[model samples]
Target: MTTNAAMQGKAMSVEEEKIQGGVQSLEVGLTVLDALTAHNAPMMLKELSEVLSMHPAKVHRYVVSLIRKGYAQQLTDGRYSLGERAHAFGVNALKRTDMLELSQRYIQDIQQHLNCSIHVSKWFADGAVVVQSLESNHVFNIITRVGSRMPLLKSATGRLHACFQPEHIIRPLLEKEWESSAKPEQYPANWEDFLELKAKILSQGYASVTGDMMAGINAISIPVFNFTQQLDHVITCIGTEDQLPEGQMQQAIDYVLGVQRQIDALFHPAAAI
Candidate 1:
């Protein structure tokens, strides 16, 4: 006689095994969809079967089901490609992706690799506001925080924004900073000086500052643009002079720019090409 507890245990074991082993048909369907996306063009039945290493009849059955569900379409030439439904699904997913949320993992990866503080900033009505930050274990007493508004001319992140953002949008902020700055002499002395600084930052495709925002601190910043090709955010890495000396600056810059490329590729895939 099986006890009630023993029967319950047997049922639980079966349920656990079922959960571990997912539906294989769904996995195969997703693989077919992924292949279509990778090919990025219409494919004949034979081509898809060859790519997926599956029997033509089986692939055809899946393709037919996908067509019925609107996940794929058969072209007039009998080749298959992603359908309107798939496109709509992708667009909807992108619409819900927040830049800061999407970038959190990348930011943490860089921080761990470089063992320095990293932050991301977005342009607000007033200036570039730090929206996210990751601190390094080795660094302490860093001043920048989530709400910190970086100085346009005194910080690497600010300088990058000044260089990439529209002139009309940033000019007023620049003037305001200049007027309110206690040590105006530390910034560009004249319009020509400011232009030279801007040109240099644009030419280099990034911005760097040494002991500008704080004594003995160094930083490098890169820009991330959205699908519309507008400056969406800036990522900056901060470290003490000893940790990011001239010898190691190039490596830090590479790590920072690598994250920028990843983000740009995600949002602006065409520009990457």
Candidate 2:
């Protein structure tokens, strides 16, 4: 129901606001890059200037800076595309932001809501290592410190990592830990039982431990998948039977699952599975 004059007025107002609030040269330079991005391919100077409604000389000036700063590349064929630095900037940005750092807020929320100790662990070359934690107010003495490395076959966090990891990556570490932990009997005598436990953890999207890693400690762990749809971090809720109780176990699992889903949705909506 709007007239052409009204739409013209709105467009002019937006342009006026942009010119008033933004640096003129920077805006023009960015617009040149924007045109290239929209085209999503190499473009000749005349084509770019025609699309942008600007003189070729002015477009060349902006493209020179873009190429110098590595935001855009001029190919040997005289066409342009996004430069290596532009692509690396995006990948490095994702790398610099740590998963545990983002999950800390969620961990604190879980602590406040459940009043149970929480541990955040990430997979390393060897195994899962605890990186952050919130102690339960009840405080029944937790021995696993932040730097503690969890057992692959025994601990909740380790089991969750093991469940999602390929066998080639986890098998050697498990064999090494199993040989050294001095708990030979604890390693399922039948290899199939271990496989079944892993299958169950993967199927349930979480794993539970009842005093396997540490005596009197019962914990549940859920994996957080990154944008690559690979398990990158694990969050474990820790408590004893006296604190978590048998009847409330599933409730705790449900809570941890909810937390994992929120993190997955927030950071990797497109990769969510």
Question: Which has the greatest lDDT?
Answer: 1
lDDT of 2: 0.81
Clashes of 2: 0
Q: lDDT by residue for model 1 over 1-273, one digit each (tens)?
A: 999999999999999999999999988998998889899789999999999999999999889989999999999999999998999998888777787777778887888888888888988887889988778887473547899998998999988887776878877888887888788677564556778999988887799988887889999998877656777788888888776776789888877787788888888787779
Error of 1 at 160 (Å): 1.5
Score each candidate by Cα lDDT: 0.84, 0.81
lDDT of model 1, residue 193: 70
Which stretches of candidate 2 lie above 4 Å from their native place?
1-23, 28-92, 180-187, 271-273
Model 2, residue 121: displacement in angstroms?
1.7
lDDT of 2 by residue, 198-249 (tens): 7777888898987787777788888876655778788888887787776788
TM-score, one value per model: 0.74, 0.66
Alpha-carbon RMSD of each model:
4.6, 11.9
Give the number of colliding residue pairs in candidate 1: 0
